[model samples]
Target: MNILLYTWLGSYTDDDIERHIRGMGINCRRIEDTQVCNGDRYHNDEFCRSFEKILEDADYDCVFTTNFLPLIARVCYKKDIPYIAWSYDSPPNLASLEEMDHPTNHIFFFSKDDVEDYRSQGLDTVWHMPLAVDTDKWDAIKTAGRDIDVSLVGRLYSSTLPVLMSRMSAEQQQFFKTLTDLQLKTYDRNILKEFITDGIAQEICRTYEADEDATLRPTRKQLLYSASTYVSHLDRLLLLRVLSKKFDTHLYSTDTEADYKSMLPNVKFHGPVSYEKGMPEVFKSSKVNLCPIFRENVSGIPLRILDVCGCGSFVLSSFCPEVAEYFREGKEAVMYRSAEEAFEKVEYYLKHGDERESIARGGYERVKADFSYDDRIRRMLTQAGVLKK
Candidate 1:
């Protein structure tokens, strides 16, 4: 089967995905259009016209992308080709799902909650597929040694927090604080939504200077969820600060100028690393990879946890039911309910080298055996009816 792999800047998994697709004996050609792919001019007619021009010459069975691209979906629908999108982001903007009802679109989300919600809306092509890793690339990475005791490789979301909080009133701020406190303590289910009343949500939207016309903007629930994610970012910053005090914690992100940097002076901060080259080494060299999942992700496992496991490194991730559903908690991976619990596990696993290595081995084997990109893409193709089972 022939596939057109659409890619853009900051596509963490595209290279590995393209390699794995070719390894499966599929004819996969990759195309990069920075304009539309970066989301800067995604909806522009110029981008769509340019993209269509490229597609006109290439004969392919299907089009594939890492995330939902509406323009591509429209073009594929016109061409009578299936447009398959594997969404790795949690709670992908509701606008993207506007095309869920499109007959030629096959959209896969990492979050089961999202899939169920869309399915309930009568979008049968929407499926729940958890994120996967390229085990071969991760397994081949070699590091000098495990120098870092604990490491986190992700964004600080520093820009999102202040902007969100600035728009909230004092009452709204207090409500949000209370809600996030409860959410940080609770796991398995999202309790933040329970705390949101329509009145409170409306007030928040008003305070945030949102568009007066409800039809032109995101719903109050989406606004509230966005705020809660800011809270989750704060929680991550706090956890890193606390952990850095006691453990040799290392942070790798481009967000170094955030206010949290001043407080985390002792914490080791490294500039951003490319996914294909540098990220695997960070996982390999860290005694424990810390995965503080975004607060918005209720039950979905973050890709970081899977990537760390693929690197054969011990991962201590925040509580996510999906993690437990896929791997033995204490054997293949470790889960923590709170920041304190995460720190405690970090200390325990650091001292117990043999147990940590065993769990890492188990995680690596599990991912290699069942969660590789080759396996995931083949399944996606079959579901899209491009490949016969």
Candidate 2:
């Protein structure tokens, strides 16, 4: 079967996703809608037009894209080719009026809650299918170790950081105190309050600001009823920084380069490396991979966990709902509830290489069995009726 993937294919995920589908013997073509200048996608008119040209030229039985490029899916829909989109996280665009602007007949969603939301909006054309990693590219490799304790490799969401900062006022403090005290019954609220009351939230906002030079220090927040992804974000950052005092730590993201260098001087900051060339080696070298996400509405596991596990390294991530659903703690991977927990877990794994290696092998096996890219695409295609079941 011929498949056209309408994606911004410069990043690690998009490239690996296409590579996995093609390896399954499907005639897959990539229509990248963005230009990577200095390791970032420049989404201008020229980039969109270039992507459209590629889509127009490619002959394919179906098209699979994320909601980021609904226009390509619209083109496929108009051409009468089956278009199936895999929305990795929440369907922000698909849930918006823009979704109706160029509505698709077939859209696959990762979050079940999102599926219900779409259904309520009278869009019955939705299916639940989570995103998977390309095990081939992300799998563990046996390389001479790079000295790093913990690392995180995702974008810095500036949008949410201000919301976290906004709650620092005396007026907002009362509201936060009440809400947190109420939440203390179920979760860790004291730690949550320190992040809010101690001006840590504002510091988080200041930390993400890029220097005038944009390279001197890499810096890299939340919501309330809004969405406090900062607690989760800072949790990872603080955990890594604390670890750096004892062991070498590194970060591999562009958004956080300035933050890492300024706030985490001892921490090695390797700004976004090419997945094709650098990520595999980086993942292979690191002793343990950290997936630190403290977002309020996070769904599906972070891609980094899969990337590290697939690369054959032990993964240490937060013990969230999705992580628990996919992996058995201490068996497939290690999990922690707080920075204290993360420190304990990392220290334990680092000391016992055999235990870490055992967990890593189990993680790789689990991903190969259930979370590989080929398996996800095949299942998605079959569900969309683009291929025989």
Candidate 3:
């Protein structure tokens, strides 16, 4: 099959996806169009015209992207070409779903909830495909002995919170505090929306100087999502802070120095690491890799867990429903429901080396057997009707 891998520059997943497609022995050509990629007006006439011209010139049987592109979907619909989009993020931008029902669009989402939601709306083309790991790259890294007791590699979401919170009054601050506590304690459901009414969200938006345009105003769902992310940031920081007090903890991220110095002074913070060179080594060397699911992703499993497992590292992840679906709970991987439980498990695993190594081996075997990039891409292509059994 001849495939055009449509991508945006600077996207972290595009390189991996392109590599996987070519590995499947398909003739793949990649085209990066910044205008259609980074632009805000994806549904505008100019974008459609530019994208249509590009699609017409590229001679390929199918077009595939890491995420949904509405303009591309529209052009493919008109040209009668299949457009396969595999989305990695959850709660996809509402605009992406507008052209979802187009005949030529085959959309895949990582979250089961998202797939069910679209299916309920009568879109049969949408499928739930969980994210997989590039075991080929990950397994090549030599397992140099475990150096760090526990490690986490990702964003802290510290950049936006202070600015947003600075505008609120004491009452609003207290209200948000209570809501975050509820979000931290609760699981599966987005409790922030149940507690934060539309009026309260508008008031908070006003304080933040949100634009007066109705389109720009934050909806209750958006506010709840923000609150949930804020809670996740705080929860992660708290977990690291307390875990550091008892055992060595390392944080690999681009978090600002001031935030770490003030909040988690004892925890070691390293600069961000790329997936190709640095992450596999970190995972291989860490005794425990922490996978704290963002609160906004109620049941979706983060890619970090899969990557860690693929590297043959012990992972203690925050509870997610999908985790149970993929791996056995205490045997292949460990799941923690709360911060206290996470810390307790970390201590137990650190002391019992045999048990930890056994679980890590189990996770690695499971991922290699069932969740490799090659397997995932083949299934995706088959679903898109680009590959035959």
Candidate 4:
């Protein structure tokens, strides 16, 4: 079978995914030209025409990508070629979910919640498949002998909620503040949607500066995103701050914020590390790799968590329903429900070297057995009917 593997920049698994596809004895044609990944995303008339031309020129049995590309979906639907998309991110950027119901389109999401949402609406084209890892590649990298204690390697998103909050009076501000605190304590779902009514939306809009967006009512999703972004920010901030005080914490991100310096006084902040070279070593060398997932990603296990485990490292992450479901909790990995619990867990794991290493080995074995990229790609292709002769 022949496949056209499309890719975009900033995705972590394009190259390794291609390797796995080819490793399955399939002819995989990789497309990373500026036209596809760098050019028009979706809904551009001329761009769509150009993409159709490219697709027509390179005729293949199927087209695959790291995430769903609506432009490809529409073109593939018209051309009658199967298009398979496996999402690594939760709430995948649903750029124009046009032609979503096409028989030739098989959209896979890592999050069961998202799959349920779409499938519940009678959309059978969607499937729930958790993210996979290329353990062989990570296993090849050499470790640096557990130099770091606790580490988090990602961006620290600053929320826009403060901007909206700035527009409100003290009373309204207090209400939203309390709501945020309560919402932060909650898990798995976006609690902001429950309270952001149309009247409240109007009040927020009234206070919101017209120059910013001129819109009257903020959508529930918009409010959820703002609050979630801030919540994610606070989540990571709190985790790192607490962990730093007790352990030799390190952060490998582009977060140069002044507040982070004062907040995490004992933490070491290093520059961003690439997904390929630097990360595996960091993961192997770190005693406890921190993975505080963005709360907006409701149920999907983030790719970073898989990568960390794939590298044979111990990860102490926030409580993700899917993570707990897939791996053995105390045996393969450790899950913490709250910041206080996270600190306590880290404290225990750091002192107990043998237990920590045993958990890491178990996690590595579990990931290798159940989360191999080669097996996942084959499963996706088979289900999509691309491999049906």
- Candidate maximizing lDDT: 4
Model 1, span 1-389: residue lDDT tens: 89999985446778888998999999999987666654643356777777778788888899999888888887788778989999888877555355567789999998888787678878888898888988877767888989999998988774343455556667766777777777767766677665666676666666556534333223556655676677677777878987898999999999777565797876888888878768889999999998888877767777888899999999998888889899998899998887888888988999999999999999999888878787789899999999999
Candidate 4 residue-wise lDDT, 137-202, digit = tens: 988899759998898899888887887777676877887898788867777556665676667766
TM values, all candidates: 0.90, 0.73, 0.90, 0.92
Query: lDDT (0-100) at residue 69 of candidate 3?
Result: 80
Question: Which regions of candidate 4 are displaced past 4 Å?
Answer: 33-40, 168-175, 193-217
* Model 4: how far residue 241 lies from native, Å: 1.3
State the displacement of the C-alpha of residue 231, model 2, in Å, after optimal TM-score superposition: 2.9
Measured on C-alpha atoms, candidate 3 has an lDDT of 0.81
Residues 276-323 of candidate 3 have per-residue lDDT tens digits of: 879889999999999988776756667888889989889999888888
> Candidate 1 — what's its lDDT?
0.81
Of candidates 4 and 3, the better by lDDT: 4
RMSD of 1: 3.0
lDDT, candidate 4, residue 236?
Answer: 86
The TM-score measured for candidate 2 stands at 0.73
Q: Please list the Cα RMSD from the true structure of every candidate, rounded to 1 decimal place.
A: 3.0, 7.7, 3.0, 2.5
Q: Tell how far residue 112 is off in model 4, in angstroms.
A: 0.6
lDDT of 2 at 63: 76
Name the runs in model 1 displaced over 4 angstroms: 37-43, 94-96, 159-170, 196-200, 206-218
What is the lDDT for 223 in model 1?
56
